[model samples]
Target: MDENQEAWYLWRHVQTQLRVSFGGIVGVDYTALRHVAGILGITLDTAMLHKIQALESVLLKKVK
Candidate 1:
Protein backbone atom coordinates (compact mmCIF):
# COMPACT_ATOMS: atom_id res chain seq x y z
CA MET A 1 0.00 0.00 0.00
CA ASP A 2 0.98 3.64 -0.50
CA GLU A 3 1.95 5.97 2.32
CA ASN A 4 -1.50 7.47 2.81
CA GLN A 5 -3.14 4.08 2.75
CA GLU A 6 -0.57 2.76 5.15
CA ALA A 7 -1.19 5.63 7.50
CA TRP A 8 -4.93 5.04 7.41
CA TYR A 9 -4.44 1.35 8.04
CA LEU A 10 -2.23 2.04 11.02
CA TRP A 11 -4.62 4.63 12.32
CA ARG A 12 -7.51 2.20 12.05
CA HIS A 13 -5.58 -0.48 13.84
CA VAL A 14 -4.65 1.93 16.61
CA GLN A 15 -8.20 3.18 16.85
CA THR A 16 -9.56 -0.33 17.29
CA GLN A 17 -7.01 -0.96 19.97
CA LEU A 18 -7.85 2.24 21.77
CA ARG A 19 -11.54 1.43 21.61
CA VAL A 20 -11.00 -1.95 23.20
CA SER A 21 -8.59 -0.61 25.78
CA PHE A 22 -10.72 2.32 26.83
CA GLY A 23 -14.18 1.09 25.91
CA GLY A 24 -14.78 -0.30 29.40
CA ILE A 25 -13.14 2.52 31.29
CA VAL A 26 -14.83 5.52 32.84
CA GLY A 27 -12.75 8.32 31.33
CA VAL A 28 -10.76 7.88 28.17
CA ASP A 29 -8.09 10.51 28.00
CA TYR A 30 -7.15 11.03 24.40
CA THR A 31 -4.09 13.12 25.28
CA ALA A 32 -2.48 10.08 26.86
CA LEU A 33 -3.34 7.96 23.86
CA ARG A 34 -1.89 10.54 21.51
CA HIS A 35 1.27 10.67 23.56
CA VAL A 36 1.55 6.90 23.44
CA ALA A 37 1.01 6.94 19.70
CA GLY A 38 3.77 9.47 19.37
CA ILE A 39 6.07 7.35 21.46
CA LEU A 40 5.26 4.47 19.13
CA GLY A 41 6.14 6.63 16.11
CA ILE A 42 2.63 7.00 14.78
CA THR A 43 2.64 10.33 12.99
CA LEU A 44 -0.90 11.52 13.46
CA ASP A 45 -2.05 15.10 13.64
CA THR A 46 -4.68 16.38 16.02
CA ALA A 47 -7.27 16.47 13.26
CA MET A 48 -6.53 12.90 12.33
CA LEU A 49 -6.70 11.81 15.95
CA HIS A 50 -10.02 13.61 16.31
CA LYS A 51 -11.36 11.78 13.30
CA ILE A 52 -10.15 8.47 14.62
CA GLN A 53 -11.76 9.12 17.98
CA ALA A 54 -15.00 10.08 16.29
CA LEU A 55 -14.99 6.89 14.26
CA GLU A 56 -14.17 4.89 17.38
CA SER A 57 -17.03 6.48 19.23
CA VAL A 58 -19.41 5.52 16.47
CA LEU A 59 -18.15 1.97 16.47
CA LEU A 60 -18.45 1.76 20.24
CA LYS A 61 -22.02 2.93 20.06
CA LYS A 62 -22.84 0.33 17.45
CA VAL A 63 -21.26 -2.45 19.48
CA LYS A 64 -23.16 -1.44 22.63
Candidate 2:
Protein backbone atom coordinates (compact mmCIF):
# COMPACT_ATOMS: atom_id res chain seq x y z
CA MET A 1 0.00 0.00 0.00
CA ASP A 2 0.97 3.60 -0.43
CA GLU A 3 2.17 5.68 2.49
CA ASN A 4 -1.21 7.35 3.05
CA GLN A 5 -3.04 4.04 2.88
CA GLU A 6 -0.57 2.41 5.22
CA ALA A 7 -0.96 5.24 7.69
CA TRP A 8 -4.75 4.92 7.66
CA TYR A 9 -4.50 1.17 8.16
CA LEU A 10 -2.20 1.66 11.08
CA TRP A 11 -4.43 4.36 12.52
CA ARG A 12 -7.59 2.24 12.35
CA HIS A 13 -5.97 -0.77 13.92
CA VAL A 14 -4.28 1.30 16.58
CA GLN A 15 -7.54 3.06 17.38
CA THR A 16 -9.34 -0.27 17.63
CA GLN A 17 -6.67 -1.64 19.90
CA LEU A 18 -6.75 1.41 22.11
CA ARG A 19 -10.51 1.09 22.46
CA VAL A 20 -10.28 -2.62 23.17
CA SER A 21 -7.34 -2.54 25.56
CA PHE A 22 -8.15 0.62 27.44
CA GLY A 23 -11.95 0.40 27.33
CA GLY A 24 -12.22 3.57 25.22
CA ILE A 25 -10.58 6.78 24.07
CA VAL A 26 -10.72 8.39 27.50
CA GLY A 27 -8.25 5.83 28.77
CA VAL A 28 -5.94 6.04 25.78
CA ASP A 29 -2.96 8.30 26.16
CA TYR A 30 -0.43 9.02 23.46
CA THR A 31 2.26 7.09 25.28
CA ALA A 32 0.17 3.99 25.40
CA LEU A 33 -0.82 4.47 21.78
CA ARG A 34 2.81 4.77 20.74
CA HIS A 35 3.76 1.73 22.76
CA VAL A 36 1.04 -0.28 21.08
CA ALA A 37 2.16 1.01 17.70
CA GLY A 38 5.67 -0.14 18.47
CA ILE A 39 4.36 -3.54 19.43
CA LEU A 40 2.48 -3.63 16.14
CA GLY A 41 5.64 -2.67 14.24
CA ILE A 42 4.17 0.59 12.95
CA THR A 43 6.61 3.45 12.60
CA LEU A 44 4.90 6.81 13.05
CA ASP A 45 6.40 9.90 11.50
CA THR A 46 5.96 13.38 12.95
CA ALA A 47 3.05 14.32 10.69
CA MET A 48 1.29 11.05 11.27
CA LEU A 49 1.78 11.37 14.99
CA HIS A 50 0.29 14.83 14.88
CA LYS A 51 -2.71 13.56 13.00
CA ILE A 52 -3.16 10.74 15.46
CA GLN A 53 -2.94 13.18 18.33
CA ALA A 54 -5.53 15.40 16.71
CA LEU A 55 -7.91 12.54 16.14
CA GLU A 56 -7.42 11.25 19.63
CA SER A 57 -8.20 14.68 20.98
CA VAL A 58 -11.42 14.77 19.02
CA LEU A 59 -12.40 11.36 20.29
CA LEU A 60 -11.58 12.26 23.86
CA LYS A 61 -13.67 15.39 23.62
CA LYS A 62 -16.58 13.46 22.26
CA VAL A 63 -16.31 10.94 25.06
CA LYS A 64 -16.34 13.70 27.60
Candidate 3:
Protein backbone atom coordinates (compact mmCIF):
# COMPACT_ATOMS: atom_id res chain seq x y z
CA MET A 1 0.00 0.00 0.00
CA ASP A 2 0.97 3.64 -0.49
CA GLU A 3 1.83 5.98 2.36
CA ASN A 4 -1.59 7.56 2.42
CA GLN A 5 -3.25 4.17 2.39
CA GLU A 6 -0.99 2.92 5.14
CA ALA A 7 -1.53 6.00 7.27
CA TRP A 8 -5.27 5.86 6.75
CA TYR A 9 -5.41 2.17 7.59
CA LEU A 10 -3.47 2.78 10.77
CA TRP A 11 -5.43 5.87 11.70
CA ARG A 12 -8.80 4.25 11.19
CA HIS A 13 -7.86 1.22 13.24
CA VAL A 14 -6.40 3.31 16.03
CA GLN A 15 -9.44 5.48 16.07
CA THR A 16 -11.68 2.47 16.33
CA GLN A 17 -9.61 1.01 19.15
CA LEU A 18 -9.60 4.26 21.06
CA ARG A 19 -13.31 4.62 20.59
CA VAL A 20 -13.86 1.14 21.94
CA SER A 21 -11.32 1.16 24.79
CA PHE A 22 -12.05 4.70 25.92
CA GLY A 23 -15.33 5.77 24.45
CA GLY A 24 -17.23 5.91 27.72
CA ILE A 25 -14.24 7.30 29.56
CA VAL A 26 -13.39 9.93 26.94
CA GLY A 27 -16.65 10.39 24.99
CA VAL A 28 -15.49 8.96 21.70
CA ASP A 29 -18.22 7.77 19.32
CA TYR A 30 -18.89 4.37 20.79
CA THR A 31 -21.31 3.43 18.05
CA ALA A 32 -18.78 4.03 15.32
CA LEU A 33 -16.27 1.66 16.87
CA ARG A 34 -18.69 -1.02 17.89
CA HIS A 35 -18.31 -2.85 14.62
CA VAL A 36 -14.69 -2.06 13.91
CA ALA A 37 -13.74 -5.67 13.35
CA GLY A 38 -16.44 -6.06 10.72
CA ILE A 39 -15.49 -2.81 9.07
CA LEU A 40 -11.71 -3.35 9.03
CA GLY A 41 -11.73 -7.05 8.16
CA ILE A 42 -9.31 -7.70 11.03
CA THR A 43 -9.52 -9.36 14.40
CA LEU A 44 -9.33 -6.92 17.31
CA ASP A 45 -6.17 -8.45 18.69
CA THR A 46 -4.43 -8.28 15.31
CA ALA A 47 -5.29 -4.62 14.89
CA MET A 48 -4.21 -3.77 18.41
CA LEU A 49 -0.91 -5.59 18.02
CA HIS A 50 -0.10 -3.68 14.84
CA LYS A 51 -1.01 -0.39 16.43
CA ILE A 52 1.24 -1.17 19.39
CA GLN A 53 4.08 -2.04 17.06
CA ALA A 54 3.61 1.19 15.20
CA LEU A 55 3.68 3.05 18.49
CA GLU A 56 6.82 1.25 19.59
CA SER A 57 8.60 2.05 16.34
CA VAL A 58 7.84 5.74 16.76
CA LEU A 59 9.11 5.79 20.32
CA LEU A 60 12.21 3.89 19.33
CA LYS A 61 12.90 6.48 16.66
CA LYS A 62 12.64 9.24 19.26
CA VAL A 63 15.29 7.47 21.32
CA LYS A 64 17.66 7.23 18.36
Candidate 4:
Protein backbone atom coordinates (compact mmCIF):
# COMPACT_ATOMS: atom_id res chain seq x y z
CA MET A 1 0.00 0.00 0.00
CA ASP A 2 0.94 3.65 -0.45
CA GLU A 3 2.52 5.65 2.33
CA ASN A 4 -0.56 7.61 3.33
CA GLN A 5 -2.78 4.54 3.28
CA GLU A 6 -0.30 2.60 5.36
CA ALA A 7 -0.05 5.36 7.92
CA TRP A 8 -3.82 5.59 8.27
CA TYR A 9 -4.20 1.84 8.64
CA LEU A 10 -1.51 1.65 11.28
CA TRP A 11 -2.92 4.58 13.24
CA ARG A 12 -6.39 3.08 13.24
CA HIS A 13 -5.09 -0.31 14.17
CA VAL A 14 -3.21 1.05 17.18
CA GLN A 15 -6.10 3.25 18.25
CA THR A 16 -8.59 0.39 18.10
CA GLN A 17 -6.30 -2.03 19.84
CA LEU A 18 -5.51 0.41 22.63
CA ARG A 19 -9.18 1.08 23.24
CA VAL A 20 -10.02 -2.60 23.24
CA SER A 21 -7.22 -3.57 25.57
CA PHE A 22 -7.72 -0.68 27.95
CA GLY A 23 -11.52 -1.05 27.99
CA GLY A 24 -12.13 2.64 28.37
CA ILE A 25 -11.61 6.03 26.77
CA VAL A 26 -8.02 5.60 25.66
CA GLY A 27 -6.07 8.07 23.63
CA VAL A 28 -3.17 7.04 21.45
CA ASP A 29 -0.06 7.55 23.49
CA TYR A 30 2.22 10.09 21.84
CA THR A 31 5.42 8.20 22.53
CA ALA A 32 3.96 4.94 21.28
CA LEU A 33 2.62 6.64 18.18
CA ARG A 34 5.99 8.17 17.40
CA HIS A 35 7.75 4.87 17.93
CA VAL A 36 5.31 3.09 15.66
CA ALA A 37 5.70 5.74 12.99
CA GLY A 38 9.43 5.39 13.24
CA ILE A 39 9.23 1.64 12.83
CA LEU A 40 7.07 2.10 9.75
CA GLY A 41 9.56 4.66 8.43
CA ILE A 42 6.90 7.34 7.84
CA THR A 43 7.05 10.93 8.94
CA LEU A 44 4.08 12.88 10.12
CA ASP A 45 3.89 16.61 9.43
CA THR A 46 4.28 19.21 12.16
CA ALA A 47 0.61 20.14 12.15
CA MET A 48 -0.51 16.53 12.31
CA LEU A 49 1.90 15.81 15.10
CA HIS A 50 0.64 18.80 17.02
CA LYS A 51 -2.92 17.64 16.56
CA ILE A 52 -2.06 14.22 17.91
CA GLN A 53 -0.45 15.78 20.94
CA ALA A 54 -3.38 18.06 21.63
CA LEU A 55 -6.29 16.00 20.38
CA GLU A 56 -5.70 12.39 21.11
CA SER A 57 -8.70 10.98 19.30
CA VAL A 58 -8.15 12.70 15.97
CA LEU A 59 -8.43 10.24 13.11
CA LEU A 60 -6.40 11.06 10.04
CA LYS A 61 -8.74 9.92 7.29
CA LYS A 62 -6.33 11.10 4.61
CA VAL A 63 -2.98 12.83 4.75
CA LYS A 64 -2.90 15.68 2.28
Candidate 5:
Protein backbone atom coordinates (compact mmCIF):
# COMPACT_ATOMS: atom_id res chain seq x y z
CA MET A 1 0.00 0.00 0.00
CA ASP A 2 0.98 3.56 -0.47
CA GLU A 3 2.23 5.62 2.43
CA ASN A 4 -0.97 7.64 2.67
CA GLN A 5 -3.23 4.59 2.55
CA GLU A 6 -1.11 2.72 5.06
CA ALA A 7 -1.23 5.65 7.45
CA TRP A 8 -4.97 5.89 7.09
CA TYR A 9 -5.42 2.21 7.77
CA LEU A 10 -3.28 2.35 10.88
CA TRP A 11 -5.14 5.43 12.10
CA ARG A 12 -8.51 3.78 11.58
CA HIS A 13 -7.34 0.62 13.32
CA VAL A 14 -6.15 2.54 16.36
CA GLN A 15 -9.36 4.59 16.49
CA THR A 16 -11.52 1.48 16.44
CA GLN A 17 -9.53 -0.20 19.16
CA LEU A 18 -9.48 2.94 21.27
CA ARG A 19 -13.27 2.96 21.34
CA VAL A 20 -13.39 -0.55 22.72
CA SER A 21 -10.53 0.08 25.15
CA PHE A 22 -12.13 3.20 26.54
CA GLY A 23 -15.44 1.43 26.87
CA GLY A 24 -13.80 -1.34 28.87
CA ILE A 25 -11.90 1.11 31.05
CA VAL A 26 -15.06 3.04 31.84
CA GLY A 27 -16.94 -0.13 32.68
CA VAL A 28 -14.16 -1.94 34.48
CA ASP A 29 -10.76 -0.51 35.43
CA TYR A 30 -7.95 1.16 33.56
CA THR A 31 -5.72 -1.87 34.15
CA ALA A 32 -8.19 -4.07 32.35
CA LEU A 33 -7.92 -1.85 29.32
CA ARG A 34 -4.14 -1.89 29.54
CA HIS A 35 -4.08 -5.65 29.80
CA VAL A 36 -6.33 -6.11 26.83
CA ALA A 37 -4.32 -3.67 24.81
CA GLY A 38 -1.13 -5.50 25.70
CA ILE A 39 -2.63 -8.82 24.65
CA LEU A 40 -3.75 -7.26 21.40
CA GLY A 41 -0.33 -5.66 20.82
CA ILE A 42 -1.69 -2.13 20.97
CA THR A 43 0.34 0.70 22.43
CA LEU A 44 -1.26 3.59 24.24
CA ASP A 45 -0.61 7.04 22.86
CA THR A 46 0.31 9.96 25.07
CA ALA A 47 -3.23 11.31 24.94
CA MET A 48 -4.73 8.00 25.93
CA LEU A 49 -2.24 7.65 28.73
CA HIS A 50 -3.28 11.05 30.03
CA LYS A 51 -6.93 10.16 29.71
CA ILE A 52 -6.54 6.93 31.66
CA GLN A 53 -4.57 8.74 34.32
CA ALA A 54 -7.28 11.37 34.57
CA LEU A 55 -9.95 8.72 34.89
CA GLU A 56 -7.96 7.01 37.62
CA SER A 57 -7.66 10.27 39.50
CA VAL A 58 -11.36 10.89 39.22
CA LEU A 59 -12.20 7.41 40.39
CA LEU A 60 -9.83 7.72 43.30
CA LYS A 61 -11.47 10.94 44.34
CA LYS A 62 -14.86 9.30 44.26
CA VAL A 63 -13.54 6.48 46.39
CA LYS A 64 -12.24 8.88 49.04
Candidate 6:
Protein backbone atom coordinates (compact mmCIF):
# COMPACT_ATOMS: atom_id res chain seq x y z
CA MET A 1 0.00 0.00 0.00
CA ASP A 2 1.00 3.60 -0.41
CA GLU A 3 2.36 5.65 2.47
CA ASN A 4 -0.93 7.30 3.37
CA GLN A 5 -2.80 4.02 3.31
CA GLU A 6 -0.11 2.34 5.32
CA ALA A 7 -0.11 5.07 7.94
CA TRP A 8 -3.87 4.87 8.26
CA TYR A 9 -3.74 1.11 8.58
CA LEU A 10 -1.16 1.33 11.29
CA TRP A 11 -3.13 3.96 13.14
CA ARG A 12 -6.23 1.79 13.05
CA HIS A 13 -4.33 -1.18 14.33
CA VAL A 14 -2.86 0.86 17.17
CA GLN A 15 -6.25 2.23 18.04
CA THR A 16 -7.72 -1.24 18.19
CA GLN A 17 -4.94 -2.53 20.35
CA LEU A 18 -5.20 0.41 22.69
CA ARG A 19 -8.93 -0.04 22.99
CA VAL A 20 -8.60 -3.69 23.84
CA SER A 21 -5.60 -3.44 26.11
CA PHE A 22 -6.53 -0.29 27.99
CA GLY A 23 -10.20 -1.20 28.09
CA GLY A 24 -10.93 2.24 26.63
CA ILE A 25 -8.72 4.17 28.99
CA VAL A 26 -7.75 7.14 26.95
CA GLY A 27 -5.10 9.24 28.56
CA VAL A 28 -4.90 12.96 28.03
CA ASP A 29 -1.18 12.70 27.50
CA TYR A 30 -0.54 11.67 23.89
CA THR A 31 2.88 13.20 23.46
CA ALA A 32 4.59 9.84 23.30
CA LEU A 33 2.28 8.41 20.71
CA ARG A 34 2.37 11.61 18.73
CA HIS A 35 6.15 11.66 18.79
CA VAL A 36 6.32 8.06 17.71
CA ALA A 37 3.96 8.75 14.86
CA GLY A 38 6.01 11.76 13.87
CA ILE A 39 9.18 9.71 13.77
CA LEU A 40 7.37 7.19 11.63
CA GLY A 41 6.35 10.07 9.33
CA ILE A 42 2.68 9.70 9.98
CA THR A 43 0.63 12.85 9.63
CA LEU A 44 -1.34 13.33 12.80
CA ASP A 45 -3.28 16.43 13.75
CA THR A 46 -5.35 17.87 16.55
CA ALA A 47 -8.59 16.72 14.94
CA MET A 48 -7.36 13.18 14.55
CA LEU A 49 -6.18 13.25 18.12
CA HIS A 50 -9.62 14.35 19.18
CA LYS A 51 -11.16 11.45 17.33
CA ILE A 52 -8.94 9.03 19.17
CA GLN A 53 -9.81 10.75 22.40
CA ALA A 54 -13.46 10.40 21.54
CA LEU A 55 -13.01 6.71 20.97
CA GLU A 56 -11.37 6.39 24.32
CA SER A 57 -14.13 8.37 25.98
CA VAL A 58 -16.74 6.10 24.52
CA LEU A 59 -14.86 3.06 25.59
CA LEU A 60 -14.33 4.46 29.06
CA LYS A 61 -18.02 5.08 29.41
CA LYS A 62 -18.79 1.55 28.34
CA VAL A 63 -16.37 0.11 30.87
CA LYS A 64 -17.71 2.33 33.62
**Candidate 5 residue runs with Cα over 4 Å from true position:** 1-33, 40-42
Residue 12 in candidate 6, Cα distance off native in Å: 4.8
Model 4: per-residue Cα lDDT over 1-64, one tens digit each: 6645655555664564343234445556666777777777767678557544444445432211
Can you tell me which runs of candidate 4 are displaced by over 4 Å? 1-4, 16-23, 47-64
The clash tally of candidate 6 reads 0
lDDT of 3 by residue, 1-64 (tens): 5534543564555553432233233322434444654577744465555654565456445544
Task: Give the winner by TM-score.
Answer: 2
Worst 10 residues of 2 by lDDT: 19-28
Q: For candidate 2, write residues 1-64 as lDDT tens digits.
A: 6756656666676665454335545544567677777877878779778777766777678876
TM-score of model number 3: 0.32
Each candidate structure's count of clashing pairs: 0, 0, 0, 0, 0, 0
Judged by whole-model lDDT over C-alpha atoms, candidate 5 comes out at 0.47
By TM-score, the better pick of 1 and 3 is: 1
RMSD of each: 4.5, 4.2, 7.7, 6.9, 9.6, 5.3
lDDT tens digits, residue span 1-64, model 6: 5635544543554554442334545443466557656777766777666666666576667867
lDDT by residue (tens digit), candidate 5, 1-64 = 4634432333333332332253243333445566655665656667656655555556545644
- TM-score pick, better of 3 and 4: 4
Residue 3 in model 4: lDDT: 40
Tell me each candidate's TM-score: 0.45, 0.53, 0.32, 0.48, 0.40, 0.46
Query: Over the stretch 1-64, how does candidate 1's per-residue lDDT look in tens digits?
Result: 4645544555554553442345473323566566656776776776666666666667667666
How many backbone overlaps does candidate 2 show? 0
Indicate the residue-level lDDT of 61 in model 1.
Answer: 79
Native-vs-model 3 lDDT? 0.48
